[model samples]
Each structure stands twice: as C-alpha cells, then as structure tokens.
Target: MSLVESPLLSIRNFYKKYGDGCLFCTTDSESENPYMDGNRCLECGTVWACRNLNFDLYQGEILGIVGESGSGKSTLVKSLFFNEEPTYGEMYLASYRDGEQNVFDCSHQTKRYLQNHELGMVDQNPYHGLRMDYSSGGNIAEKLIAADYSHVGQMVERAEELLEKVEIPVARMNEPPRKFSGGMQQRVQISKALANRPPLLLLGEITTGLDLSVQARVLDLIRTIQQELKVSMIVISHDLGVIRMLTDRTLVLNQGRIVENGLTDQIMEDPQHAYTQLLVHSLL
Candidate 1:
C-alpha cells in the first residue's frame, strides 16, 4: 500500500497498570488522572507502566519517545508491538482495517500475522530480534518465513540485498551473528526488521551501550534506510542525540505521561515543560 495522508497508527487512551486497582478506588467511576488522583492501589501500590499513551504515527515519519529508566518508554512500545497487553485503550493501524480494527482486540493468530507482516521491531537486545543460532541469512529468512515467503532462491537474493543495504558485508551472510561485533549484529537486526518491508518499524534503544562511533554509524544507517524505504517508525530511546538525529517529532515521557511533544528541533532548542528543559539540558 502507498503512504497515506493520515497517520498509519493511532493509539488512544492506552493503559498498562500492573495488579488490581488501588484501595482508593471505591466505585465504578474512575479519575481521568488516576495516578495523580490517589487511585493507586493502597494495598499493593499498582501503577501504570504506561497510561493514556495517546499518539499517531504518520506514514513515512520517524517519531521518538524519550524518557529515563522506569519512565514507561519500553512499556509503551511493547504494548503497541503487542508484546504487552495494555489494560484499556484503543489502537488502530491503517494497514489492518482502514483504521478500524483495534489492534489490541485482534485474536492471537491475527496479532501474529500483523506483527509478522505489517510491523517490525529491532529491540535493544539483539537476542530479542535475532536468532543467535541462525546464520545472518537464515535470520532474515526467518522473517521472510513469517511473512509467508518460501522461495528459497528469492529469499537468499533478498537477504543479501538487505545485508548490503545495512552495510553488512555480504560475505558475512552465512556467519552467525554471534561472531559479529555488537554493531554488526545490530546491523543484521536492522536488515531483518526491514526484510519484510513492513510499514512501521519499532526501534528500542538500538544504540544504547555501543561505542560512540558505532552509534553514529548505526544512526546513519537508520536514517539512510528510512529515506530509502520510506518506512514509518517509532523510536524508543533515552538519548536526546539519537532522537535529534533521526526523528521529525519527539515525545517526552515523565512518570508515564507525555510531558511534552513537538518537532525534534523545537523540543530540543526550546523545550516547554520543566522536565523537558531538564532533559534537554542534560545533553550538555
């Protein structure tokens, strides 16, 4: 499908709080701001890892979510990627049903189908995205298999093309990712994620823990791929630099809420929220 004028993904009032509601909750009525209104379970202290995470991902755009540890950035993406089931909310993907199907309500099989065909994720940990036991080519083939591509000859041809696009030497295609450096493995992960030509890609802290030089190269590769493929993306990260380098727009998360959101340059150069100001300053 071609890029649309509307957002490719829409999330409304998403919530993912662990445990039962707090003792403060006495009736069916609920506070719009449950966390601040003392709705937390008084007995167990349950809290929303992600709450009211509302946003839209336009086709062919990169949106960044930045937050500190425990700030729910991971939870938010995991929920959208269907790794974690959100408590309550509505999610729609343009590829699914003309923005009609709530992604969260799809059956397990349909969810898997959407995940395999419509969306791709390269997680912070390579293990989450790569088959450590499989050769790099084999790993890409796994994605192809999930997408129902079974022509062995074509799969090999496509896999090599992907590896080349991500700047991985085609000679290394037969080697297991374990033999590659962290940066190389990440490249392979990127290749795998893009193998299916998914409409949306989910990036989870891909540069964390890498050397600065490695991070720069990976970031460059991501920028190149997005430009070449015109894929929409949701980038999850704590580093403002990564967000600045890759995203057109960014959202700042504090205590699981969107503290601020705007163009990447605007958010960095003229932050509006106090937390966002501190976050921008921390870069210095």
Candidate 2:
C-alpha cells in the first residue's frame, strides 16, 4: 500500500541483462540471450540483483543513491534516463507538457530531446563527460549549438556567465579540460551539463575525485545553482556523509538490489537495512 505513493519517476518490475558472461542477462529469460554470447543474469534465484525493483523520484528532490560497486546503481539510473533499456517492466519520466511517458517505449528522437531540454547527467569522472580536447568555452557552447541556439555569440556570453556561476574564472574558458584541476574540470563539466538549463540533473559520484575542500565548494555551488534555478537532481555516491548533507531522500543499494529507501534523515539516523546500516556506519 505504501509503495503506491506517486513519484516523478517510477520503476516497476524492472529487469536488465548485460552481455555474455554478464550475469545481468543470462537468468532473466528462458530463451538464449541473443544480443551477446553467454552472459547470464546475476540472479539465478528469485532476485540475484534486481527483481521487482520499485522506487519513485519526486520533482525538485535530490535523491541520493548509495551502494557498493556492482550494486546496479549505475545500471538502474542509466535505465531511468533511457540510456539503457530495461529487459521488462516500466520506467517513466515526468514531462512538463506530455505528463509521464515510458522511457524505454519513447522514440529515440523523443528521448534525445528530453535528454537535451529536461535531463542532464554528470558521471563518476568528468573526463568521460567533458570533451577533453575542447576549450572550456567551446565545451559549454557545444550544448547550445546542439540545442540549435541560433545566437552563437549570445550563447558564448551565457557560457561565460555559467562558467563564472560554476566558479570557473573567465581566463580558463579558452583552456581545454585536460588543463584543469580535477575540481575545476568537474565544475566545467557541470557548466556544460547545465548549459541548456535542463530541469533534471543526474549525478553519479561526480565529486569523488576532488579533495575535501574542493568537494565542499562543488557541493555548495550545486546547491546554490539548483536553488537559483529550481532544478531537480539525483545524486549517486558511496559517501553517506555527502548524501546526508546534500539529499532530501536516500536509497540504499547492495549487490545490485535496493535494500532501503526513505527520507535522508530517516535513513541516516535509523537505517532499516543491514547494508544501509553498514554503509552509514562507514561514513566519516
């Protein structure tokens, strides 16, 4: 009954299979996994990793995803954004105009447009997301170009403004991502991701590589920008300390399954799952 609550993004009976030797695929279906060779679903049992996984993300809410390596955090989030299609069940994204639509069922063009105008993602390493060869300004400008903003000059100006907003000085705009410090590069990545003013930002361990002070600044900057823009975000991190400070709600994941989901405070103060309790305990 409690699971029936509304969520901005909801996943039901979600399933995924990776590839040959990747357990995600082998066990889900009776037929031989066609796409790849010999991969298997990790869960040969009722639920090895994720089975009947259910959760909801509310608008303007920072939903923290916490889990150890190979916990299906990345897999599940990717599915939500339509980057990776789920094997069975459904995932929906709330649209401003069209209401909620199934992510996997949506047309490629529709998903691409939503990814541009409404969604943003910052991965574990900014290097993977940022164009290393392009200047910071160019990187930021590229999004606008992709969005078909006709006024390149105006967009460049806005890019500069965004660089400043993310704490990247104007002098560094001409520099490539390789020249920036990890923190600075991550900031530039954030700037580029936010260039189109997407309504939702999906961040996966984005601040992991930065030092404490830099991480603090980036966190503050994100909070500031989100408040100013009224943007919604989903942050995935292994650090409960960071999640406790940054998120409104938290989900605990282990071995590719969600063990706990609740308000951030509740999860932090009184964890229900053993994995969550262990994770919270390990936070510094």
**Leading candidate by lDDT:** 1
Model 2: per-residue lDDT, tens digit, 1-284?
Answer: 68654556667777664532344444445354454322223334223344457777776778888888777778776766667777776767666334466666778897777777777788778877889998899988887877778797898898999998987889878999899899998888888889988878888888887999999999998889877987878898888877887899888877655678889999988988887888878877
lDDT for predicted candidate 2 compared with the true structure: 0.77
lDDT values, one for every candidate: 0.88, 0.77
The 10-residue segment of model 2 with minimum total lDDT is 37-46
TM-score of each: 0.93, 0.85
lDDT of 1 at 78: 88
Clashes of 2: 12
Candidate 2's C-alpha runs over 4 A off are: 1-7, 20-50
lDDT (10s digit) by residue, model 1, range 1-284:
85547789999988778778664542334335443443255456776576667889898999999999878999888887889988888999998889998989989899899999998999999988898988999999999999999899999999999998888889989999999999999999999989989999999999987999999999999999999889999999999999999999999998777879899999988999999999999995
